[model samples]
Target chain A: MYVDVILNQPASRDYRVYIDQLETLHFDTKVLIVTNTTVASLHLETLQKKIEAKELYSVILPDGEQYKNMQSLNLILNACFEHRLDRKSLLIAFGGGVIGDMTGFAASIYQRGIDFIQIPTTLLSQVDASVGGKTGINNSYGKNLIGSFWQPRAVYCESVFLKTLPKREFSAGVAEMIKMAVTFDKAFFEWLETHDLEDEAHLKEAIAKSIAIKARVVALDETEQGIRAVLNYGHTFAHVIENQTHYTTFLHGEAVAIGMVMANILAQKLTFLNADEALRIVTLLEHYDLPTHYRIENVEAFYDAFFLDKKSEHAVIKFILAQGIGGYEISRNIPKEVVLEALKEANA
Target chain B: MYVDVILNQPASRDYRVYIDQLETLHFDTKVLIVTNTTVASLHLETLQKKIEAKELYSVILPDGEQYKNMQSLNLILNACFEHRLDRKSLLIAFGGGVIGDMTGFAASIYQRGIDFIQIPTTLLSQVDASVGGKTGINNSYGKNLIGSFWQPRAVYCESVFLKTLPKREFSAGVAEMIKMAVTFDKAFFEWLETHDLEDEAHLKEAIAKSIAIKARVVALDETEQGIRAVLNYGHTFAHVIENQTHYTTFLHGEAVAIGMVMANILAQKLTFLNADEALRIVTLLEHYDLPTHYRIENVEAFYDAFFLDKKSEHAVIKFILAQGIGGYEISRNIPKEVVLEALKEANA
Candidate 1:
């Protein structure tokens, strides 16, 4: 199955996201496969055999989120220079979000942009990161603080690659899938409640459904100016959670899962989501063993951190709240006391 | 006077290039003016006084092409973060090509791209670099080997900024203007022969004319997929010249001036230009005291260097040769011996 990401952009920038469809790819240009040590060790040969290029090279980066820095970015770029990859050359991102983001960022700036393909190995990346063109390395200030909205040439997602995924990591990917379902598709949310993703056939359908929703949202607002922000249903809170825990305690999707529950609390305050509706979402996340709670040590400190988020402009925090199921509200000017109340509730 | 660069891109990407027009500007968001030491010492205050923002900051990098690297780019990006500049904030590139390229590149990646204005200080920048959305920093491999096609929101070109420009630099700027005329406008080329740019009014007219030509060419081919390569009429030879001299002997425009002469020799070989037409170009370049000749040390080495240029793809050098004045040709498969003979003649 495949989802066409029809971005309301130049036809050149629009691409498709294929689910469980990894075909024999061929290119007449220099091709660089950028993967991490973990993915390289497990699945590099599988990916390598599928691609035939005039020149093929792979750069193995150390696996982990912490390695997603300028040093790694330079490693990818230096590899391009060393291999003499030109503007027409291509890059294949063959790992999780870290590899995809770094490879996409490298392609965006290499010779003022080049074509890059995303072969997402992790479910987290396949469902979310690989679909969006948000590519950048982190700085001392924050995550994805520096990046470009450079879309990929195409994205290939294969379920076979996920056979080796750790159980926790697999659940983390479900968090993003759940985030998509809760915000945009109550039917998808209901589908998740009834179906078991552990079954490969059911998992493929969910991935396609989630990517289709994401593609539609991205098409509406490629730069996250409007409806695209709605896709960040849990990210506003998730960013703060990740930063507070130094990104070591929780996977990004796991934080988003907890973030969704926290956002549901705020939605209850705003009457966007009823208690029963919020409970259903939490029950589904827990079914997948996804974390749906967090301890906020200092509500004030967390509140301050929202102002530092890239989405929060000029001290105005845009909260993405679930308006019951399959609906959302972007609350830009919610009173501080009301948010503090929700934070207190989430803390409890 | 102003020339609107109507890029066939999204409406948000199209911008205007204002010549001899630097007006008071205001922004509701934080603004950072990126300049260099030399430009800051002379005109930072001039530029700063004309802009009012909620918060204003300036980062003065060391001046020169050598400083146009990752370090300077980092300095600008770090300042944006330090000032807490958000997505809505703006950057003003206030210097020559080096500052403009670095600043524009920083804006392109900072927070996944933001709005920036160009206030070009040098004649070379005002007429050329400031108008193009090409933003990048040089690396160990080559000049502008890494960058994005990020157009600025607007460009303000004030001849007043040129008051402090050295005479040699001014002539170098003229080399680019001459290049624009020779490739796109025969009438403009003829007018350039009779007119004296040393006169302020004539210089302003020439600047506007050159920019208008650039604006038209850019509008047609924003990504240099086709006709835009014509703008690099002299650059094919110039890159080699710059590389050979380690970029210390001549300004970029000066090197381009010599490169134009070398290209003309090749063009004459192809019967693209008569001997008189070629001499006219050389005479105009010499009239401004721009370097019209560079003795090639090794014809074979210089020919090999062309392949290293980013424009060269798959070891195929695409030479942008003048097809007499006001016309150009993008020759993809020029025979080796013919080009070698031209190089040998230029060697003399």
Candidate 2:
């Protein structure tokens, strides 16, 4: 399946993502494949043999979310400079979320922006990160505090790469799909509930559906000023969870799994979602062996941390609640008592 | 003297640059003014008195081009985070080029990009830097190696701020105007030759003409992939000079002054510019008390430095040369001997 991610950004018309084999993306411009050490060791030679470019170079970065920093970003950039990849050159992000984010960011900044493709090897990036054009590095203060909404020229998703993907990370990727389905497509959510994603055909359809939903939302609101916030579904809580755990404790999608349960509890408290409907979402997450609960260390501390959230404003927190399936309601200033109640329900 | 800079970038629509007094923009969005210590100490209170925003906050950064880095950029981001600035929040670049660049970069990355306004306080920024959407911070590798092309919401170019600008800095700004005139508008170049920029009215006109020309080119090519390369008339040589001198020996425009002269020499050697026309541009630069020559320490080393330039590719330096005024030509692979001859001519 070829998914066309059409972003009306300057000079970027549109690009297609081939959700199968990595086709020959023939380019006259110089090409640099920015991948992690693990991906490079596993798949670099194969990619080099397949991709036809004037010059193909590989920049191997250290594997893991922790290595996604300014220091690691420079490694990719220095390679571009060394390779003399001009403004017209292309950068191929050939790993997971961390690699895609860093490579996209490097392309956005290099010579004040260039073209880059997303060859998302991990399921998390293919379904979410690689499609949205949200690219940046995490600072000491938070995750993705500094990034740009730079879309990729194309994205190639080959499930073969997921064969070696860690069990925890693969499960984490499913959480994001469940996120999209629950918030935007009731039929898709139902399909996921009945379907075994472990089956190759089921997994590919889920990935394609998730990307299409994401592509539509981003097209409508690329900057996330309005309806796009709906796509965040559980991201507000996920950011907090990621922060509280120092980002080392959970893969982003893993945090999202727990975040969805917390959001569902909040939805029930706000009377936006019935208890039974919310429970269905929780059961789906657990079926995949994903965590569906997290205990707040301190209620007051957890509540106070909301202000520090990237979405919070002037002491008012903006919440994205699922309005049953295939719908979302954005509420500003959900009463402190309601939030506290939701936190109580969230307590493991 | 109200000049409108219309850009056709993704979400960046048309923005006005008030060369007159700072108007009350009356933004309902939260406004965070990003300025330097010097500019803030001089005019923060005055700006506070003039501008009316819903919630006005200021982030005062350290002063100097040397401080324009990711660390300084973080200072702005940290302030945004501390203030809990949301998606609609606007950042004001409230100083010269350094402030505008870093502030614009911060806004571009904050929440994956937000809106920013440029309030250029220095003559250099008013004429050149403020109009373009080019924003970034300097890194260990080089100046502006890490940045994004994020345009501002608007620009307020009040010459009143330049009253406090130092003499050397003021002259440097004149060099940028001379740069614009020499490359794109011959009529403006002729007007500049006869007029005295020291006189306030003439200076204002020169500034306006420079901005209009810049705005026109930028509108056509927000990304410098084609005719926009002509705008880099002297920038290639200037970067090499700035690098060799450790960026401390000369102001940006001062180096540009010398760079333009070097480019003219190369153009004359290629017979692209008549001797008299090239000399006229050189003479006009000198009239503004800008440098007309530089001594090459080592021609081979200076030529080698060209490859490191962001504009260079495949070891073939793309030289933007003067093609009599109002016209310029981009030549790739200009013979090394022709470059060597130009360097020897540059050596005083």
Candidate 3:
């Protein structure tokens, strides 16, 4: 299946996203596949056999989010230099979000910008990271603290890559899918309340539905200048939790799962989402085996870090509050005391 | 005088360039001035006083082309992190091409992208570097081998900064002005042949003319996918010379001066530019006290490195040959033997 993403900006670009099985990938230009050791071990042979190019090379990085730093990013860029890859070369992000983010960031800077494609292997990456033009790596200060908006020439997402994903990671991916339905499509959220996602066919449909909503949001606000903030419905709180835990405690989707719950509570306090509506979303997260609660070390510290968000302006931090499932609003008027109260409510 | 450069690409960007005296700059956003020790020592105080911002900071890197690498670029990114510079912050490139290139590259990847204004402080930067959206850092591989296209919010080209530039640097700046004139504006090239650039009025008019041509070419081909290659008319050979010398032998504009002479020699060989026209251009460089000749250490070695250019496609090197002056073409028709002959001619 092919989906189109329109970046209605200067030097207007539109790219096709292929989601199905992997086909023989070949390029007439220099090509580099940036992958991690884990992914390489699992699928390198199959990928190597199926892909052909004028100059195809691979740079293997160690797996895990900890390695997503400037040192690791340089591995990809240095490979480009060592191979003498020019503007005509292409970079293929062949792992998960970590690889996709780093590869896209590298392509964005390689010779002032080159072409790249996203082959997101993980469910989280397929539905979120690879779809948006947002690409970055974590810094000592926080997650994705460094990056830019560089859309890929195309994306090839194969569901087969998820067959080997561990149960915890698999569940984490579903959390993001649930987040999408809750934020944009009420009927999809309602369907999730009764559907059996364990079925392969059902899961694929859910994934596509999630991607379609994300594609719509990105098309409207490629730079997150406005409506795109709604896509970060749970990311503001999620980034903080990841930062506090050094981004090593929970998978991104897990943190975001709990973040959505906290947002629901915040919305209830403002009378935007009633108690029943909030619980319905939490119950759905539970059904998906996603975390719906989190504990804060210090509410004030989290509050201060909130203002440092890439989405924030001046001292005002915009919050995405749920009006009801599939309905949300971005507001900067939430009282600090209300946020502090919500933190206490979310305490373990 | 104000010049406008319209980037008609994805997320099209347009900004005005102020090309006259220094004016007080006041921005409500957090701002950081990324400069080198030499340029900062010369104008930091004056700049600090004239620029009013919510929060202002400075990162002083050592001055030189050799320092334009990833390490120096990180200094700018690190300062941004230290200040907790959110997306709303602005970075001011307050030096020559090195500063402008590094600062603009930093802003392009800082939080995946942020706002930056170019405060180009040298004549070369005003008429050349700051006019285009090209920003990058030199890696061990080559000159500007790493970077991306990131347009600045605005470029403030205060010719007043030229007062402190040493005589050699002053001459280097004039070489770039001559390159712009020779490549895109024949009238401007003719004006340079008889004009006294030492006169401030004449210099300002010359600088404005160089920028106008650049602004027009950039508007049409922001990515260098077309006419933009004409702007790199002299850069191909210049980059190799700088690479062989480890970017320490001469200023960028000085190397470009010698490179233009080589380009003219090749153009004459192809009958694209007659002997008189090439000599007229050479005489203008001499009038500006710019080097019009360079000796290649190894002609064959230089020829091999030419294929490594960001402009080369499928091992085919494109040459921008002058058809008289202000008229050019991007051609991949030059044979290896012909290029070798021209290289032998450039040998001392």
Candidate 4:
């Protein structure tokens, strides 16, 4: 039987950044912040000031996508061990998706399971990764193929952290915002069409709307069994690009930006989406300076990667094709010819 | 809101246990069996006979408690990467508790998560580890410091594997059996008093009873929020003892044997149990020749280890003390002095 896991809403907190002060979010024990060098340089002090606990410690790891593997997981576990962090000690995932996923996973595994709070500092993380409780590290097999549906005790999405984010990074974050809009909220989709993401007010509103959309989807389908897959609208194609490029070429949002465009073309070809709607998506993505297409090196090799993806399994590719801008249908046993045609359009 | 996650039991399957039949469980995908050299030598041929996957492989790790750590976890993860186990493949954990814990943990993080089955080859593992979804490796801080509550897709328990087990190992499994009876089933506990564990019929009944108790408890409290902590009737002291002895000095069950004896004394002192009931427990453990005590070289150091235990936090240690043979209570805020006194008596 499926379970409806509650998603706790973030509480109100003043937007401030420092190296380390003492405030009480009211946890009963020590708190350990799991982050890396990059985040430590920028916001660790700020986070330290905001969180008050009986005891507080920081474990800084070497930062990079390359380190998002089992070795990094070991490092996180080691920190928890060394600190004697028990089931009572709270783990704060203080970086972006990689840190959030790894730290949440560490908390999930530590002492069988423990409480963890998400203090997501990246746009991609605040709107997407922080909500799902999808904790895992990437392996050679594929991204997020191994993970647990372990949610956090609370999520502190302080938009203040976005101040240091690069323009491209902010736009990449917008990609997921747009995906959520396209798959679930047409009003939000329309809002994105008219607003410039560079406007911080508009971006905050978009992030909130996007997260709410994701929250609704997740509340209905916590385990990604049905409606939750809508969140993966562009991710299927995006994961291949991310893997093929060794996850270095495209910021996750950038890959999804191109992936969304490719998916739109496939939707249009199959009459799942109108040409005008597809064009509108492409136009908006281009406005953000997000790549809308990529060169395909080898068709079959690229096609082979889809089978390796966690989404498509048992030789059945379950494609999330749009029924225009606001609706999606998960199609299964999708023929290779149709997928190949979509791949060609993606390359084009 | 508290969410109860219940696992629906799948129909059991009959599996062939041969040292050479590992391939039959796979379907054209890579298969990796994370086991130690001891189990590999004893039953690899039997496993090999069943494995007919596209790629069949094994990584025989160093056999023993010392190897159940982060370095070994890294080794297991590295083997997965080196062997190139894909997303669709499977990992079979084919040893006792250490193997099961490490392998289950490795699978949990291998790609985020992967499918794995437990082929528990020891009585301790077959009756205990195989039933709970508790998968983890130990750390310097304490046992099972890093792990997940990840349930296996299936568990294959073949009583035939026990034939090769040493006498001490067989007795260790019975300790868990005794634990199950003491906590949940009073009638079962009384029956155990008369039945010899060496008899095959009684052994099978005991194993089934132990599994059923664990399965019920786990089904009710998968993440150990409430009543499930009662299952750790002796683990509070067991972890401390195991930690002090460096885990190599005794099998987990043997430590638990001594721990149960210590807990009984504590229970009697707390007025929750009578000495008569405690003595009956001592007599049963003695019948199996399981160690009932260990000298505490340093009482302060042993006490320090309890704080490092995953179950302990701050100054409070949660102890599972029995009211009598069939009644249990999870006592938190257990004073160190009380625990020390029990330890002193057990040692004497």
Native contacts recovered, in order, as a fraction for each? 0.80, 0.82, 0.89, 0.72
After best superposition, candidate 1 residue A85: deviation in angstroms?
A: 0.4
Which digits, one per residue and each the tens of the lDDT, describe model 2 over residues A1-348? 977777656445577777895766699989999998899888888888878999889989999888888789889988987887777899999999999999999999887888998888888988998888889887666667677878888888999888888889899999999999988999999999999999999999999999999998888888776888887888888888888998888888989998888988898888889988998998999998998877789978888887776655566787888999777889897889988888987894
Query: Model 3 compared with the native: what TM-score?
Result: 0.96
Q: Candidate 4, residues B162-200: lDDT per residue as tens digits?
A: 888999999898898888889888998999999997898
Off by over 4 Å in 3: A10-12, A296-311, B10-12, B308-311, B346-348
Off by over 4 Å in 1: none
Judging by lDDT against the true structure, name the best candidate: 1
After superposition, which runs of candidate 4 have C-alpha atoms over 4 Å from their true positions?
A: A1-24, A243-249, A297-318, A331-348, B1-32, B47-59, B74-90, B298-305, B308-310, B329-344
Model 2 chain A poorest ten-residue lDDT run: A5-14
lDDT of 4 by residue, A80-189 (tens): 77777777788999988999998888788878878887878888887888887789877665566556767787677766788898888888888888888887778888
DockQ values for all predictions?
A: 0.77, 0.60, 0.68, 0.43
DockQ order of candidates, top first:
1, 3, 2, 4
Candidate 4 CAPRI level: acceptable
Q: Give each candidate's interface RMSD in Å.
A: 1.3, 2.2, 2.4, 5.1
What is the per-residue lDDT of model 1 for residues B51-97, given as tens digits with 9 covering 90 to 100?
A: 99999999999989999999999999999999889899999999999
B246 in model 4: Cα distance from truth in Å? 3.0
